[model samples]
Target: MPRRWLMAALLALVPAGAGATPVNAYPDIARAYWVEIDGRPAWAGNADQAMPVASLAKLMAALVLDEEADLAGTVTVSRAASAATGTRLGVRAGETYLASDLFSAMLVRSANDVCRALADWHGGGDDDTFVARMNARAAELGMVSTRFANACGHDAPGQGSSARDLALLARAVMARPRIMEDARRESFAFASLDGRRFSVRSTNALLGQFPGAIGLKTGFTPGAGRCLVALAERDGHEVLAILLHAPDRWWDTVGLLELAFDQARRNAPPE
Candidate 1:
């Protein structure tokens, strides 16, 4: 049988309506996928394919910030940062914001300006250096299929990563206390050096909508389509779902999490 038909057959086992979780019903539109259950690989489909990941790459920026940069200091926004497009924070050149605040903007709001601002600050006013650090860190983490060309995850020709590599990065991000806390919150608030107040809300919609949903990140571009790295914890079991170009990410993630936990439960020895 064809793959789509097989998937459909598998999904037919799920009951409709109340308490039904569609297992193996991932959308055909998804380009690459990976899921980890309790820190172990549970599913994979073309998870090593290098493709544009859009704002998901900003997770690396957050990782880099946590490892190398001074997160508590103040960073001045440069023209390069102020000029960032595709998700703006309305920051202007010559403005100064807390490095911690900018980091919050990058994760919570997916603000490209903060990505650039933080990178520039870390690189001593040079983004290239920061990108080099990102690549190096990815390599150190065994992300062989990943590369970063820019601080913000813009669609550049050479900028691409695989789902598996991103999963590894996500594990590292979750290990850090600050990064995990930032991901869990819906919004981060702070005042600028100029004393203007600003609040940035996270782009991850699953927080309030889905039970046990914590965070990760979301990415999209004309080329990347809808991408998401979702983390959900229930009954002390954690599941991480990574989907690239998935048109129905929120639903798929929920289903995938349900299936993972169910499978794990079935495999457990009787007490």
Candidate 2:
């Protein structure tokens, strides 16, 4: 099916007044944002505007890896991966590590090195191949407004994602129990085949501080600014909020989640 037709079909299913963009609800919230309560859009702003999303792109890479790669398999780091910029696990070239370990660090710490390594491994020594797979998967997921330039979320021309597109991506990630399990963790400990110990903590600050906060992802870049995909559950209600280029993501996410849950309660069918 055509991507636009797929998106239109998806939008048509939203309940009346369910997915309206209310810019006034939260001023200066972000460049683009979207919030959903149990898969139902509650509020949004610039939801379809394509913009830099930083490491949030990793979510899509992680999704592609989960579907195509074996977690139990091992991967050897490449020079390109070892030299990756931004946040990284500091993995040296030629080091061998479990794909699962690299996956954990990539998601939790936003480690660029390990992310690149995994991408190289999955691409059979070519990151571009992996990126092509990411783009193909994005289209399949109805993320028409997204594009991937690299395995690690790096700033590059022609690489961007929209708030709504990321919401769709996040939903796919949430469906994977293993990925969610790793994402929610406060920290992860692992070692390479040569016995190099490494410890990494979750970049998602909400894990311990926010009520019912669980596994999600965070990102930042000079171009992308601070981005976040926050998921929280309370009383069987799940709230997922995506913020791109948010200046105050921590506070904004908390407020958005609270509002989403409240809205969910208010809109509940009368008992």
Candidate 3:
């Protein structure tokens, strides 16, 4: 199936009235919300409360890789990287790719293999080094509530951040033109040293579903329920919407971003 058509069909299945509920409406489900419109923090609920970030940590991991190594440089894969699981781009050991290609896979596909490969290549051949860089970057970014124990945000305890901190990180990542482009990519293909080709699709449903929605990240674990940092732009204004540990997680996010866009449009000054 064509990937865009598949996503469009999935979106058609979701009712247009999904966002009609009130902003705070949910059936006995606890949620954390933070919204920033046109460069200001305009709305928040439990924004400072800490929560597990899951794979959203990949942004930092990719940033660290960009800093420590040349994105245009080639990276040789190792066994450790090939072994990573969950939402992968199916990279094999002994294959080589430009660091920028792998970084694209890391951000757009949220591929564990690409992330592991970046960790191995740039972090002195160990994920611990990659994690340390994430921690240091978090501190440098003033993300005091964040502590990354791994490059990919798997369900390890103590690996998490608050809505506020993640928002800050989102803003930072958004500022990077390259990373932002990668994040917004719906699909891309990467070629290996052996001429084998692999492609991946974005995991953030909102990318293709919601109009004007762009890139960010998504994560899930039995412990984390479902978490997402979703972004959308309309009429020259960008809004960042976040939800942590919410039921009907996908719909919750879709609803939130839609509401945010609507609110922004309503509040937008005369052109």
Candidate 4:
């Protein structure tokens, strides 16, 4: 049992089995994993390793924009924004767009270009300044193992965060209804100022397919493999599951949720 969880430590006093599933039983191939049961730490695996988090770093962008930047303001796409590659919105430089739309582009579409656009706009100058603020926010949130090198979570030399740190981020994000609303969508259509149209589908596979799954996010890279921060609400209870560098995140998340919820129910004292 992970000693960091006081609940787990107390539960250890019971007979060995305690109707709990061992953390090792789940097929967690990710570099790290963490599960929160009713907003409490419950289980973890390699939860402290700072590994390439792919687009998961975009969570910081979402935070920065929500807390500091004006989403209603228009953003002028910069040369750097237009040049961003991989899972991008393909926005053009010199095009003007609403900051909120660009935000949707980043969260709903995981569009790299929009992320860069927001970073540039919110940084008040450059991405480094934005990333510096990201680091500061992480520290403010007490995410000691996390760091950011860029707004979009491409594999940068110093860009990395741990599953434990991400769990903190997930909680902070979920508390913001606006951010949750954006992450909860399945797809959205966005049009630039010049009437150019674009459609995007969410990379998060659980929203509709999984019962009770709500707003959260997903990530991928050759280095990060598959990363996901998923939240679900059932019977007025919420569960969060985090996976980093896992190939089968869909199944892994499902299995972890089922196992964790079952344990929670088993421990509940007769309703």
Judged by TM-score, which candidate is best? 2
Report every candidate's CA lDDT: 0.82, 0.86, 0.75, 0.82
* Model 4 vs. true fold: TM: 0.90
As for TM-score, the candidate ahead, 3 or 4, is 4
Indicate the residue-level lDDT of 178 in model 4: 81
Task: For candidate 3, write residues 17-126 as lDDT tens digits.
Answer: 32232233322223676666666665556767777777888878877765667788889997988999877777888889888889998888788888899888887787
**Candidate 4 clashing pairs, residues 3+ apart or interchain:** none
Can you tell me which runs of candidate 1 are displaced by over 4 Å? 1-29
Off by over 4 Å in 2: 1-24
lDDT of 4 by residue, 1-271 (tens): 3332334334423321332432433333467888777777666678888998999899888997898888989999999999998899789999988888899879998999989989998887598899999999999999988888888999878889998899989988887888988999999887888888888999998989988898698999888889999898876667788899987888767766765666666555675
Which prediction has the highest lDDT against the true structure?
2
Which residue segments of model 4 deviate by more than 4 Å? 1-27
**Candidate 3 structure lDDT:** 0.75
Measured on C-alpha atoms, candidate 2 has an lDDT of: 0.86
Q: Give the distance in Å from residue 152's predicted Cα in candidate 4 to where it truly belongs.
A: 0.7
lDDT tens readout by residue for model 2, 1-271: 4453344334434443645544324436788888778777766778899999999999998999998899899999999999999998789999999999999989989999999999999999999999999999999999999888887889999899999999999999988987898889999999999999999889999999999999699999999999999999997788888898998899768767876776667667887
Query: C-alpha displacement of 22 in model 1, angstroms?
Result: 18
Please, what is the TM-score per model? 0.89, 0.91, 0.85, 0.90
- What is the Å distance of residue 238 in model 4 from its true position? 1.2
